[model samples]
Target: MASVDLGKVLDKAWADKPLAEVLAAPVSALKGVSDRDGELLDEAFGVKTVADLADLKYVRWAQALAALDAAK
Candidate 1:
């Protein structure tokens, strides 16, 4: 899978968006996520947005990577 830049995914425009609103957005909103990968995230893991991706219980690796990538 390509590396996703979470900062880009959760752009400044979304700084004040509600968690639920962020979670409801399509995975495609995430940088470096292809349409297919987005589908897989939703189908395989029910990951649909930045909030979902931040969930450590299901997507630990993603959570870690997001932290690192977003920090940059």
Candidate 2:
């Protein structure tokens, strides 16, 4: 299993949470993402939780594009 240092990616309040809880946390639970940013994402794309952001079609497309670019 791959171990991740959650403190590096999540906000302090979320760092100690379980994976499922973290995934269900609001986007603001991520490091450097403000509550306002979470609100904007919610308003724009119906993205409420980290899982919602990860599952977004636009995010998947962008990730694929970035991977293709990196492979070039």
Candidate 3:
């Protein structure tokens, strides 16, 4: 079987433009996320994929929301 194309797996996610939504993708699927970032995220956040990202029940959403509000 061909290896999964994780990069292609989440192309639609980038277009959606929501961190909560995009976080559901494989961490490897993101732009600019070097393997180093992947390792760090997994270790620090238990975030191996986008679903983990969306599930972050902490300060991220609040921070993003604050940034968005500040931009207004």
Best by TM-score: 2
> Could you give candidate 2's per-residue lDDT for residues 1-72 as a string of tens digits?
779799999999999999999999999999999999999999999999999999999999999999899999
Global Cα RMSD, each model: 7.5, 1.5, 9.6
Which residue pairs collide, candidate 2? none
Candidate 3 Cα RMSD after full superposition onto the native fold (Å): 9.6
- In order, candidate lDDTs are 0.69, 0.97, 0.69
Name model 3 segments beyond 4 Å from true.
1-25
- Cα miss at 23, model 3 (Å)? 6.8
Model 2 segments more than 4 A misplaced: 1-3
> Candidate 1, 33: how far from true, in Å?
0.6
Q: What local lDDT score does residue 15 receive in model 2, on the 0 to 100 scale? A: 94
lDDT of 1 at 68: 100
lDDT of 3 by residue, 1-72 (tens): 677454555554474556565666577657666668878988998888867755677658787899899999
Which one is best on lDDT? 2
